[model samples]
Target: MSQHPLARLKRYDIESITRYYRFRPWLVFARAVLIVWKFAGFLLGLRADRGHTNPIRRRQRAVQLRHILTDLGPTYIKVGQALSTRPDLVHKDFLEELTRLQDQLPPFPNDIAFAIIEQELERSVSEVYQTISADPVAAASLGQVYKATLHTGEEVAVKVQRPNLLPTLTLDLHLMRWAASWLGPHLPLNLGHDLLLIVDEFGTKLFEEIDYLNEGRNAERFAAYFKGDVSVKVPSIYWRHSSRHVLTLEWINGIKLTDVERVQAAGLDISELVRIGVSSGLRQLLEFGFFHADPHPGNLFATLDGKMAYIDFGMMDQLEQHDKEILIDAVVYAVNKDYDHLTQAFVELGFLAAGTDIQPIVPAIESVLGNVMGESVADFNIKTVTDKFSELMFEYPFRVPGRFALIIRSVVTQEGVALSLDPNFRILEVAYPYVARRLLSDESPELRRRLLEVLFKDGRFQWQRLENLIQIAQIDAGFDLMPTAQLGLQYLLSEEGQFLRRKLLLALTEDDRLHTDEVRRIWNLVKGEIKPDRLWGAALGALATVWPSATALVTAFTPSEQL
Candidate 1:
């Protein structure tokens, strides 16, 4: 058998090796060694300054680590933040602590920043901009943002990469690869996916982030996805003045999403913001499969007109279609508290490897969810549930796929922002309706078959699916009527549609007929309107009358506040 080209053995290119040597490989090595050497002293000081057992001391230590990582420049801060998401690599305390590991620094001088822009664009700063801020609006490990006005008079936020950032970060990645190679043998669990795999994935994502052109395309792609959406916003990029080192985008001035008091003071509904945030995030994850991987509060804002504008397109991720299906299944199973099905989803999704003992995994998941979600699944908190579950799953042969790690982190962060404003907000309750709508609209033959198998158990349609559908429809207000009605009409007005509709109605209604409440509601609507000579649309009128669920379904399709 032939091995795959990627899997085949290959020789190292001495030219590339020598190129690294030429580009100050010694400097990278020295910097890495110096950082590691300093780490020993850091550990000693870390212990001497605080007690590990005390919560206050631990928090103080966490803060110390946060500051240390931030000061370590872009690579360390980025690597620390990346590893913080993986439960297998770090503990819950460190994970929570690392969340405070902000990527910020004193802005490098204005001259150097301007110099880089001029060099990249091949034009003087005066030619590129009418006026550029001498001081940066925000500075971070990798880049700084400056408010600039283009010669064409468009207000823009110009992001400038730090001087020599790539060379430094590239060297740090080499050190990381070396460290991962060293750590692989010492790990107790035979993790199918090792540190090398994680580092490689991170390297690809980081490389993408460093390329401003890629960031520009990501912004355009995301904006195109939500082009007409009034609730969501992605700033347009001014690519004429942008490049690998600098990204210029339309300036978005809005209140930070985390500043709840000010947002409320500005007369925007905090709860509505939460709903929009969760819904939009889910659509990216479940529908588009491309998401802004870092949707932390700082990267999000509410415009003066209440639009949720997203910035920072550097760190983005993609969810494959196969993964999306498994995720959808996992969510639905979790919502139903069907741990067995959830385990099945994990196995199919390759989170838990095949042939592994799933018993321990199944009940463990069930216990965690039961404790976190409580008896009422609809009222479950997604952030708490996922956090607790992640902490538990690390014990098993469970791997948080790279795609899901970012998605989970982004969502958990958003949940914190949402909870800060509304204590009663339930993300699952807001998201489940979208799940149902997706299920209903899915045209895939496989999904259709699955739906039939699950809902049409024992030969006829099970009324429970109808009940659940109604329940989900009532909760999701984004229900669109015409297209859904068109699909239903195409199906119902067809031979198969008519057959399935009658069969479902027969299974749901009493003897395939309307009940007293249904009859009364129908009579109340059409008592005086129905005439002896006019019987137009009588079948739909009767269908709506006979089934309360159908009435709710039609109401879902109609234009209304909560439809």
Candidate 2:
């Protein structure tokens, strides 16, 4: 086997040795290679003595681990956050330690930053920016931000990608997948599935972050969604200068939202700001179905005009319409203490398996909620609930979708940030009213009309199938011999099959072509089972046989202007 490329990059330490032993016991023989140096250090008294194992050393070790993960690159820092959420998957101490993993990477050289800018925008910095600062205002895992001024004299924040970040991230993700695959079968948990999914999600999010065009669109979408709201603000994207790796936006000169004293000094009501923040987050998650996943305090600012400005659109998540409805149902079910409904929602949402026992989980969930739900919104502890959920998930080992996990984390983090501003701030209190309004106000007249049309169409098809079945019965009565009777039964089966095929084809033809897999599968099934000898089946079967190929050909060549 070829040696793992990442193995050469990683340090072989006592901890690595231990992890290897636990995860891959066949590597026990390799322990000799690592132990020799440790023994030599111990004999020389150069390593940690018993007295050195103090709380301060432990703290320093935690700091060192944070630095190591950050140095390992963006993917590792993301993995740190992921592991922090699953206390069951990792040791408690390690989870606590990794939580300190910050995205405070040092900025790449200014020359490289400028090169990235020039390459992405296809112009010199002077052409676009009236004054481009050499120094970065802030630095994070993926990119760094520089304060700049546009040629039009508008102050803007220019986000520049760190040189060679993609290559490093790609390498890390590949290694992670490889390692997960190697250890998956022997591990107690589904490390392979979880790790691959997490890494894939990270890659998708990372790529989106790198694509400044997508970020620009996200910002515009957020702005357009909240256009009438005076209290909320999203930076306007300068499309002329923006590209995949570079983003230019209107910069707000404001205080960090977390700076309560400064915000209060600026004549903003902190309590109202907290309320608005929580409410805006809920709207993003539940209503618009698109949200800023990383709404940490640093990404939010309170402007002098008392408007909440959201910055850094790098990590945005979108919930599908079905997913949004499922989450809402789950939230409502939880509040109502409807365990069965909650479990069913979980299954429907793919959070829990269909066969999983709900009986054991109810008491655990109820105990976790405890008096937290009954308490005033301001008094509720967001961290307590978050921790309880994390712990429960660990014990239960439920497979939550990555998107859902990130959404939950963002909601919990936003709630925590709000609570930090006002101890009396209740997330549920603010969220409840918004959810209630959404439930009551969402009329969806078009959706209701469409649903009725579908039911009516299905009823017509069923009646046609019944009439065909009766006709087949009459034909069967005419043939009294056993072989003829069997053929008649087959004919009836084929007729019924044709009716099913027609129904399916009508349904598929009317629906959007986006569901290609489903359409192809149904079409194939219909084509394979129905035959031409059966008159009722022949026409329907012929359509199914031709539609998939026709659809494929259209999908293939529709993009090209052809003769």
Candidate 3:
């Protein structure tokens, strides 16, 4: 028998590589290719530093990677953009290159775009539009946007998916899956399971991006979430021409946030726009828990009327209620330098494994905080903090939750953009106050009432505990307690056996197609027909007797009254 290459590595490495390889063989190859590309890029970056008089070579390297990503098509472009957010994984120069991976691609044939619109709307181009532009106003990885006018003289933007995108994406994902599976057992990196998880998530997101109907719903959802906000604008979905592949939205006339001169020409206050952008993003993450993940300047525009419009909603991330609370707590702890609470919270949130030593993490957390916390919160440098955090993450090898990583990137990017506009602007000052206000609201009357109910229940629980302690003390004083201890242990074992039996039964019932071997094993375990022991078999026998009574008791508690 041969030892697998993955078997030689540590547990995390084996888990990572095996997880991806189990999916498909081609995905494994894709993973290897990406890793090699990253290493090659790193080496090239080193060479550019070796006696190159022209500093422009570094920028050209980035541009080359961006062009390659673009040429690889939509999925790779998306992967490149995602890599742009991972400063911890990529070098600064590479991050710059990946960021340059433009969402803009050349438009598909105009004839195909027109055909898609006609098919989706069930009308001729002449009937729906007084005038339709032959050229696209914007082109993106998956689709292109054209300017058009309705028969009623209303202007709109028509989004059409690139022809045959679905098939291409499907083929690419299939290859990725295959590569993941084949490479699972050999990789030294913990690339197995995590890689597959990322691939699956990517596939799902890619599919959603191609679905215009989903994008339309996302637009409506964003609009509803920010309904009363006068500063924020989300385009209205023109449902009449919208379909799975085609979307028509209200035409937005605005200058890109990146276009400094154009924005100035339009008489928009740049600083105020940047503030609004940052504030709106904080509200989305902390308040709504649903946000537009792609917040690049191209996706953002500033209207002449001083309103900010967010255009793309194809890529969004949501946080669960518990995850949101954990994030809030983590942020608060980070500010206050509460290392213990932060470590505990990380364990509770499964960011750290159970029984992991915390001593190693405390110093790293303190070191990272010490460098930044000494500075005025308003003047703290985001890039420096980010770099320190990234270094700590790699050194500590802590498992960062996927959503948290994305949120960190989103915040850092927004901060960078804001600082570029106004060097004196303090993101922490703007964001922290809003978070503090929300935290304070958590103690309002309604919340207080809920807290009271919980506290009262906890008080009753304490009383019950006190009564149990008194009873146990009395029993210990009155009796020798040896027989009773043995009996109690036996009863506990019996109860555990019954619980496991019931769980197995429920599982078998849900999955009716259980194999013969599985059924035989279940029967053997429950019936004590094989390898019976006093500890386990006697417990099983006791459970068999008590199971009926327990079922009866549960049935008796059901309410007969109807609402």
Best by TM-score: 1
Q: Which of the two candidates, 2 or 3, achieves a greater lDDT against the reference?
A: 3
How far is each candidate from the true structure, as Cα RMSD in Å?
A: 7.8, 17.9, 19.6
- What's the lDDT for all of these models? 0.74, 0.64, 0.66
Residue 558 alpha-carbon offset, candidate 1, angstroms = 23
Query: Backbone clashes per model, in order?
Result: 1, 3, 26
Considering only N, C-alpha and C atoms within 3 Å, which residue pairs clash in candidate 2? 212-244, 377-426, 378-424
Candidate 3 residue lDDT tens string, 487-513? 333443455346434544454454465
Would you give me the overall lDDT of model 3?
0.66
Candidate 2 weakest ten by summed lDDT: 476-485
- Report the C-alpha lDDT of model 1 over 1-563, residue by residue, as the tens digit: 22222211122222342356456667767877777875766688666855446667667666667766776788888877886677766656667888767888889999989888888898998999999887999998888999989888899999998877755666666777777899877976434587777777787787778788899999999999888778998999988889888899999989998888899899998878888898899888887899998887879999888889999998888888888777777777776677888898888877777888898788888888878777665568876766686577567778776767788788888788788778887888777787777766565755554555556645766555545754575466766433443454455655545657776576547565654554455355334544432332344444554555776677667556432
Model 2 regions lying over 4 Å from their true place: 1-64, 91-97, 190-194, 375-379, 445-563
TM accuracy, model 3: 0.68
Superposing every Cα of model 3 onto the true structure, what RMSD results?
19.6
RMSD of 1: 7.8
Q: Write the per-residue lDDT of candidate 2 for residues 140-208, one digit (tens) a residue.
A: 888899999986789999998776665455544545555656766677862324655665666667667
